[model samples]
Target: MRFLVFSLAFCAIFTYCLANRPKHDVSEDNYLELVREIEDEIAKENELKHEAREKDNLEQAREENGQEKAIVGNYDEPPYTDKEISYLQLAREVSDQYMEEIRRENEESENVGARTASDSLRAFSHPSRRTQMLAEENERQDAELETLQMLASGENLRMRNLPDLTAKTVQDDPTCNTKLDCEGKNLNLVDGKEFRTITGTCNNKLNYTWGMAGAQHRRLLPNAYNDGKWKIRKLSVTSRPRKKVFLPSARKISNVVHKTTKPKPENEDSISLGLFYFMQFIDHDLAKTAEGHVRKKKICCKTPTKATKFCLPIVVEESDDQFDKDDCMESRRSFVVYRCNDNVRNQINEITSYLDASMVYGSSEEEEDTLRTKKAGLLKMSTEDFLPISERATSLPCNATDVSTCYEAGDTRANVHPGLLTYHTVFAREHNRIAKELRKVNSGWSDERLYQETRKIVGGEIQHIVYTHMLPVLIQDSVLDQHGVTKEYDYKDSVDASMTAAFSMVYRYHNLMPHKLNLGRLKGDGVETFEQFNQESVFQKPSFVTRDNYDGINEVTLGMIQSQCPYVNRFMNAAARDLLFLDKNGNSFDLVALNIMRGRDWGTPSYTAYRALCGLGIATTWNDLTNTTDQEDIDKMKEVYADVQDVDLWTGVMTEKKLAGSISGATQSCLLAMHFANIKHGDRFWYEGSFSEDQLEEIKKITLARVLCDTLEDITLMRENVFRTNSDWKRCSDIEGKIDFSKWQE
Candidate 1:
């Protein structure tokens, strides 16, 4: 009854606030501020309602059982007292059925008749994967609690050394540490959520933070560390009389495997550069590993002993032609933390682990707030219909220039390259385009409601494109069919949606990048190449995407479609292999080297281990690798790795021959299958169920070509399948089944 009373009181308060809204016309920005203020009040009121309900439940339990019970009153509020923290800890250890009962009881107030998947779990006797994961979590927690307590007292981990937590954190504070721990992110999840959260929380009905930002990446196998502690993999085993694996340098592996002299083979499908750039764009959408403090090049490369604990510099042999003797590539370890006091270390995924176009909408609520105009529910953009220009007073982050300054967007890495930034600009336009269309029909909708609804539609379109248009190119149709990755209506609460660390390593398609990026126009007679750039010159350089540049965002966008991807073999172009992310000093990092070393940093199991896991026949010796890997590649692997089991996951993946009708190999195909399959099956609010049948059909009809046509005004022509170079070309006006937002009207 207290819950109902509090809710009624909240309605009265909210109504009064709305009634007191400005009678006089205000500036657009001021109007947005007022709307946000009301939204904040609503969130506060909802939080209070939860606290009151919990308090009521406690009192009721105490009276009936003749005993005291703890309650988390003002649950969502900060500065959680010890008693409240204890209650939260206690809640974690409870049985799944009990948690479901709590959930059912909580929802019974608003949804008495609705049945959830958990309702069926109540009748089951067998343990599930969720239960097993929880058990593993409990075990890890028991072990890691000691380490956390010790670390709390230890005078170590300076602000620079801390893993992904705020610099403001006083390391000794238990409350602060609790918030940083995995599964401890404070998120508000309620039943019947209309749209996915910005941070990817609440995707799982049972586990609110399963794939949320700051959550540890899911692992295919146990981390392989030398000490079984916090060390990068070096030794062959962590057991008795450990033999040093003496792993080959990541650079050496790169030189041997990717620095190919043989003639490069073109993509069999004649895939366009647009699809290659999309590979990068969507990858940014899915996962981003948290980076540690910026590396101090002098400390990391010159003085090893004085370096911060986070520095894990890659050694460049003295014989290397690129630099002086004893030079090392400056690097920092990824930010990691325990699983809420668990003993294991896990790298954090800094973005939402869904195909929800988080790159267009920032991953966190705080980040998202900066990207919105809050007027007519549109995202912030420049007057030129380009992304908003960066100004915290013109301080540059990447290779951005003052004239063609880096534009701010949902993701910071939007400025990494011209092609990637083009996608960001196009998607931001799409959001506003959808918002204005929605407003035309339903002007009565509040700013908040309109924004969320538009966000929902955009997210739906993104998922449809990824599952339908993108995955087929990356994997075989038969593999997708076998895994049911493309199927809708497979939402299972039991499935965990967390991204695997292996997928990050396997999806590095650096080999396909062309050495040069060309801007051209396809006119009546033939194509005219107007401008060109060495791909390295534009690395982290935002100028190429700006209107001032010769080949601006539009030219880059069109050129990418017209330009051909050089090849799809294991060999990387000179730009990617030797000049990627070329710093101001002209020093660049090797993509293949970075990928191989990251596997060590992440502690992903060896290539053979993953092969076994994927049901690809394992190689006990070099001779056994023939069926899975080519003979020539097996010879290369034998040269680099000390043992068959000791090969890096990335190296193994590259050498394996591509499957028939797919760009990926058998193991790569399996991992992608699992990743996409779980992503679809695990999401409680997946696009299919979230939209009406009519709306879903409209979304399905939408294509990347159609989106490009609709957004890029200058792009008069496009291929039906942007991924295929030989696909039939069409005029923008002739593109069929373009999404009509009017069908979305109430």
Candidate 2:
């Protein structure tokens, strides 16, 4: 029963198992088959889900694309800040997309081990491919960030260095017609504008600045204002009278002379009297005009004799029938000789009689006596009278002498007869006397001493030139405003006036002499230190600072020296005297003032506008904290720190090196100066920090006596071989030699 029953049960059980379990293996095969079926179903479901997802992704992509297009279309109208935010958001999205792509690729690489592999699986596993893409992405983002940083920095710099802030501000003068007032509704400050909303004030004197008013005052207006259409309007102004001011005790001496004086004529034998020759080369216009005049006047000249003939001729007629030829000739000769007064006739008659009586066929006592008497009579007469006049009476046809000293000749033309040379000589003498007088008024120097001193160095010719040319430059610059011809503080006009004065003075004196007036030539050999050869040269000896000071303030001094001049950097051949003023020993005091004044407008100590006021000697009031900064005694210090935060040059004081007190005080002074004078940095003086370190060093070296005083040729020869040679070569060949990088993939 067990066998039979077990067989039946076994059969049943086996059949049941066969029906329930996998038939082929009932173990690994069956389980695998089931697993494969389930996998197939799951795959089918997954495929459907993937298709749905793909459709969703396409819709999302389309929506995203539409949004991107809209954003791009409206990009021009969007606010810059909004645009920046949008770009930042796009960058974040891109980063997120890249990170997600990396994760997906990693996941795919892991999944590839369990599934049938494809070429894409290998590509997804390649670390170098992802690395390259990531590197490119990171590089692009880095560049964008760097560009943004640069833009931000540039904007901040632009704000910090407003190019025309001073120009925009109204001059703080009550007399200014464009001055703003907070009275009534004349100004926007009183009208409660969007730019300004002053609710109340004590007679408008203490009104609050708001909106545009505050923005402008604070220099918060962006660079966009550079292109705006705006007009300045005046609400109120003062009618105050202006006062005249004179140059300080420190008068800047000019090299050119200013005035002239004419000397009185003397007799032929006067010891002081001498012939003066003045030469002039006419300008194109004048020469052409003179030439035209000559042509119009029908003036003619012949060679050899080269005699000039005037249009109005003096004629002589001869008639042969009137008298015998010899007799007529004798009568004509007699007429020529005796056509004079009784005194001249008697003198001639006696002179001829003595000569005739003195002549003898042979030696005799009576003839010798007669000859001795005639010689004695000739000796009593003036040398001029005894001598025969030559045909070429005038050395220069145009030259004129004292009429009383010359036998009157009819050859001199009336128009051009008073020679240009003579006129100029007279002009020069007169000019020198006037210039000397002008100099004495303020210089406290004696005229004769000046004349003697001047004479020893430059001849009377050059002295005359100085008076005619150089003196007017100083006078017109110094005194013209007092004479109601101009005004003080008008810099362009002032510079123009000064230069014109200089030019005119140069022109007049230059015309007074025969030699050409070359300013460059005048500066030949430069100025020397010793007084032994102290002549009309412009350069003075160098006033060098102590070696200790030189080392300590090396950078500052160099910058100051170079900044004052423009040519010291670009042109190596600039004259030594021109490095500063006429003097070689640069004016240290003026240099310091210039340094301070230059800072009034730019960089760390920009006080250009301030110095303009101070330069004008205007009284000003500022906050006590600021004003007290200048009180420090800095005579001992050499280094002047131009800190970014400070507005004044702070002398390096051992006790207060950290404090910026001097800066504040100096800034106040400069600001006050600017408000008063309306001076610009480039106009009044050179600012430090304008030059690079290398340029400054080069310029400061100019102060060295040996460097500047040396000839340019010598300097050129010495420095001819010195240069910066770049020797390093780039690895361009290796980089170019690399094969196509993608070839490895093939």
Candidate 3:
């Protein structure tokens, strides 16, 4: 009897200890098993919820059939959809099931210690202490499980889960109709004349300190200057109001000059195809659309009889008749008007001189979110078969469910042309490559840190390329020196970098576009076979890069350098003239005409006025233009305009002979030089300024050639001067010319 009691007591104490062992102290295998069991239980609960939903549906159906259901008093709302009702039912069932499981588990854990420990064992082994410890352990395990569930649902992550709280909230003014009208309320306007300068209390509402840069008030209220309030000066012969000059129609001018002038393919003196693309990239970085019209309907032009308030067609005049008799559409569709923020008299009311890599990284919080992947702070790239590809293909995203438009980094016009798209792709890839390198170097750095650092480096590269390679070629060294655009770094508050109307008009160098895109591969022996593609065919198409195992981009890069650009003249390529967009019914619109019209619409003074402003000789007669332009070009202007004073800036600039050792004419070169000089002087974060000595050194090493070699795939050989067409192709492995990114490493 004694032996039997001793053995029973020993067995009891051993079992009690085993039962009371801490539930949190789980072995690896057992912990995994527990997780699997919990997952299985959750799955079973979902199944039960689904079944409960089905049963509820059946019961409701039976009740409806058995008796006439009475409607709730005073409520006439329609019943919820079957899917919606079912989802709600399932959610309720799941919640109830989860609660019941938790309660049952708690009860079982609490009773385990009590059931295992007998009265004699409890006295000797301290049952209350063991039970309390077990309860505490169970609570911890429950808390941990809950945390795991939350983590799995991705609720704990910072940028990934939370809404962007830093987004700007813009309030629209109800009284204002147009952007110009909003500014007019505060300004004193002369009868039949537009407000030339911001006077009075108008300066108080518009903040020039941190707001957009404008042309007029260069010091205190720069953003308010020329807020679409300037009027085109009238010609000496015309009696039209200054605000309402009866200028020639954009379409009519296009038909006369652009349609008549055939494509004159004249290669630039020494500039490369890379330079052309880089210019376009820079254009997009600085400018955006002024608040203007939008197209109401796609078919608005087809049926003029059904014209509404939204339909403002570009009426083609009889004198400029270049279109075929049968195919000549009477009504060319116009853009629909969507005014900018009239309250502030600015587009988005943001400073334009920041040059904060808005072209690559994006400008707004929403845009930033769309561009970011939230994984290592890398910008999102369009993928092919789950493999990372280029910047999300322009028109469509990979996972787009509908025909809605897709997103791109920085600018919307980045994918408007093939060359622009190629550059965007290279820089995007560069950002990712740098981010990956940074991650490797600083193992503990987060995605945000890596992305920002990479962005800074890319911005620096752009600044270096523009200032070093492009500016020298565009604006001659003499003009740069005259304008004080020296390499010396200084931030001047008085210098306004706002894009002037003349600057914007002159920058439209569509005449430089080649008719055909030369696509070819550069061989090891520095020879290549060019495959010519019509420029219109690849306008917004990015799929061309994926051809030949993604080697087409390199081929095109080489081809652009090899192909010659057309001379800057009235003539345009057939691609730009004949097929700008399919919706326009085979190039119904003309780009040159649009440029002239846009300049006038923006209320910019004529070429003579701009010449006077720049301290050059103002031409009063057609013969006076001989000093600035060729004799033949002057005769062409006489036929178009009544007097030299009426000549549009765009027409005059394009016709002028290219300045000696410069890509552009005198007026264009001057405007570009002044604008760029101001952009450098005014910008607080100009790459050369406020950088560490080491950072500045690294930035100076960056060049367009290095950027191309580093970012482009399989670009083994590259010319030293990427901005110029040359036969000196050197291997990318040549360390003499290559930029060393080691200094950027943490």
Q: lDDT per prediction?
A: 0.65, 0.21, 0.52
RMSD versus native structure for model 2: 45.6
Which tens-of-lDDT digit does each residue in 1-746 have in candidate 3? 12222222233323333464323333433533433333344345445555455445544633432222422211454432333333223222333343344455544433211121111111111111222333233222233233333323432322221111111112222113323322654443333322212111122223333323221212111221123332222233343455434556555555545553455656657666677877888876665443221121223345545543223234455533344432333232111112234333222212134455565755444455667888885888764211133343312211222212223655555545667767877888878877787777676766766666667777777888888878887777888888878759777766666655567678888877777777868776463746887775665445565557767678877777655566656567766654543232333344565566555544456777766656668677777777778887777667666667777778878777777877787777888788788778876557786466886887787767677787775887777777777547777776243445566565
* Model 1 lDDT tens row, 1-746: 12222222233333445475433333433533433344354445445555556466445533332232333233453433233322222222222223333345434432211212111111111122222233333322322232222222332322121121111111111111432322323333222235677887666646766777656688878888655645777655322455444678888878777786543556767788888899998888887774443211224556555654446777876445454556566665665555444456667677778778788988888668878988889998875788887653122234433534567776667776888888988899999888999998888877777788888888888888888888888898988988778665678888887878998889888877887887867676334557888887766566676654433877787788877786666688778776666654556677788788888888888998999888877778888777777888888777777788888988888888888887888888888898889888888778888888788888889888888888878777877788887777788888875877778776
By lDDT: ranked, best first:
1, 3, 2
- Candidate 2 residue spans exceeding 4 A from truth: 1-89, 92-604, 607-609, 616-632, 640-746
C-alpha-based local distance difference test score of model 1? 0.65
Model 1 lowest lDDT segment of ten: 164-173
How far out, in Å, is residue 212 in model 2? Answer: 3.9
Pull out the clashing pairs in model 1. none
Flag the better candidate by TM-score, 1 or 3.
1
What is the Å distance of residue 648 in model 2 from its true position? 3.2
**After superposing candidate 3, which stretches have Cα over 4 Å from the reference?**
1-237, 240-245, 255-262, 290-295, 298-312, 319-354, 384-407, 583-587, 735-746
Q: What's the TM-score of each model vs. the native?
A: 0.74, 0.14, 0.64
lDDT per residue, candidate 2, 1-746, as tens digits? 11222222223323433554444333432432433343343334445544445344434532432221322233444322322332233223333443444455444434211121111111211211212343334323333333333333433422221111111111111111234465555432211311111111111222222111001111111111111211111111121236323111100101011011221122112111011111121110010000000111121211212211111111112212111211111000000011112111100010100001011100122212221222111111112121112132221121222222221111111112122212222222322332343344425434433332222211222222222322232232223223322223222313111111011111221111111111111112221112111111211111011113322112212212111111100011112111212122221111112222211211111122223323422223222222222323221111222221122321111111111211112323233222212211112211122223443333232211112112111111111101101111112221111112121111
Judge candidate 3 at residue 73 and give its lDDT.
Answer: 17
